[model samples]
Target: MIKFENVYKEYGNGVRALLNINLEIPEGDFVFLVGSSGAGKSSMIKLLIREEEVTRGRILIDDIDITKISKYSVPKLRRNISVVFQDFRLLPKKTVFENISYALEIVGASRKEINRKVDRALELVNLQDKKKAHLDELSGGESQRVAIARAIVNKPPILACDEPTGNLDENTAREIMHSLLKINDAGTTVIMATHAVNIVNELKKHVVTLKDGAIVSNIEKGGYYCELD
Candidate 1:
């Protein structure tokens, strides 16, 4: 489970990124964080990933407080949360298989384990055939799928995606969403920050909308905020 209790995040420039934000996401839940740019969507993602520290309040993942963990311990906290970004940051020199394997290698996984996990992750994203393809060789959607495979190679309990489909077209974005949904179905909690209103309304899962650093709405099976109200 994920919980935020009276969380406040303020920057050195005196900008308040989040204020008194409280939320909870149960295990295996797929949640969408929807809002305009600077609505604190990115701030929430950063806090959960331990990339930024909160000014006040607490964040708990699986009943453990993440706010109190030290910088060195931040890496250990990341084992439970894997992040995917909008840019699909795959290494340019590596093939799909090697790209995914590199993530495991950093954590000191042996060759046998890396191979097995990479194969499974590639299959999950339906990119097993592209295992030998270079990053530059794949299309935008395919590249994002490779990024997804890399993120999930470690089998983390939570997948945090930030504007994953921002660069894809309608059809390709749909494909990426399907890949994410498949991972969520296999019991990984997903917290996605997206502006793809069509996809959000279509999926009709839980949505937590942020406006001016505070939660404006949280709806179960909700449609886009603009269309709903």
Candidate 2:
């Protein structure tokens, strides 16, 4: 559902973040993006989210050219995709229900529809009991689940997560991965950018490894080939 054709990204002051990165992700496929720091993984995510413009080439999502999408229409494009961050970007003052409800509110959903979606999303994440809890009252994993609920409340066709397990312990991270896997199984195309080698190795999923702004490897059912320790 996503294709990058000779995509390149360069920051100001002549620093190139991505170089001719060509890749394709089919619909309902789960993929992992692996790279060291500054290897362009974050840049790729930014490009997909339209937080950064491609310096050259094109990006197509479901055959629509995102690179040429007008600023006024970017919001429409983003409505089809959802993103989860390493840091649970929840509003500190909002309860879990309110946090997820805010997403539907922005898209002009009716109050009844918003209530239904928010409840269903919370149930999917196993956080229905925590719906009334504030962000400060949640554990790390619970907070992340809330974030996931918010992301999927709209039922976006594609989901991208950046270092989602960065701050959790192994068991907690695995719990998070299980939730992501469940989402994938339900047919949401998932692209996760993570450094947790153990989870990547255990999942045995499609892995695209990058180095110095270029793809070094793209393997189906891959492991952590990099020697970090």
Candidate 3:
């Protein structure tokens, strides 16, 4: 579970990015964080990854109070909540398999374990055939799938995406969305921030709309909604 209690975030230049936010995301839930630009979606992603600390209140990931986790434990916390960005963040020089395996290698997993997990991850994204392909050889959607493969290779409990399908066309974007849904179906919590209103309407998952750094609403199995007045 992920919980935010009265969480507030103010930047170094005195710009308030989040205000009195209270949220609770149950385990295995898929959520869409949607709003116009400068709506604090990025700020929430940063806070979740502990890249930015809350000015006040607490953030609990599985009730650990991530706001208070020690420096040495930050990596452990990250492993629990993996993040993916619009940028594929893959090595141009490495094969798809190597890119995903590298994450496990860093954590000192055995080669056999790396192979098994990588295979499974690639399957989850429907890119098993591209394992030996280089980054440049894959299409835009394929690259994103590779990035997703890398993110989930370790089987993390939560995955957060920042504008994941921003660079793709509608068809390609849906492909990316399908990959994410497959991952969510397998029981990992997915919180994605996207500007793709069409995808949001189609998925009809939990939609959390933010505006001016505050959560206006969190609707379950609901399409996009906003206040006009």
lDDT of each: 0.92, 0.89, 0.92
Question: How close to the true structure is residue 85 of candidate 3, measured as C-alpha lDDT?
Answer: 91
Q: What lDDT tens digits, residue by residue, belong to model 1 across residues 175-212?
A: 99999999999999999999999999899999999988
Task: Tell me which residue pairs clash in candidate 2.
Answer: none
Better of 2 and 3 by TM-score: 3
Off by over 4 Å in 1: 227-229
Give the runs in model 3 whose Cα sits over 4 Å from its true position.
Answer: 226-229
Q: Going through the candidates in order, what is the number of backbone clashes in each?
A: 0, 0, 0
- Cα displacement (angstroms), candidate 2, residue 5, comes to 0.7
lDDT of 1 at 168: 91
Q: Please write out the lDDT profile of model 3 over residues 1-229, one tens digit for every residue.
A: 8999999999889899999999999999999998888889999999999988899999998778999988788898889888999998888899999999999999999999999999999999999889898888999999999999999999999999999999999999999999999999999999999889889988899999998999998898987774511
For model 1, name the residue pairs that clash.
none
Return the TM-score for candidate 1, rounded to 2 decimals.
0.97
Which candidate do you rate higher for TM-score, 1 or 2?
Answer: 1
Q: What RMSD, rounded to one decimal, does every model reach? A: 1.3, 1.2, 1.2
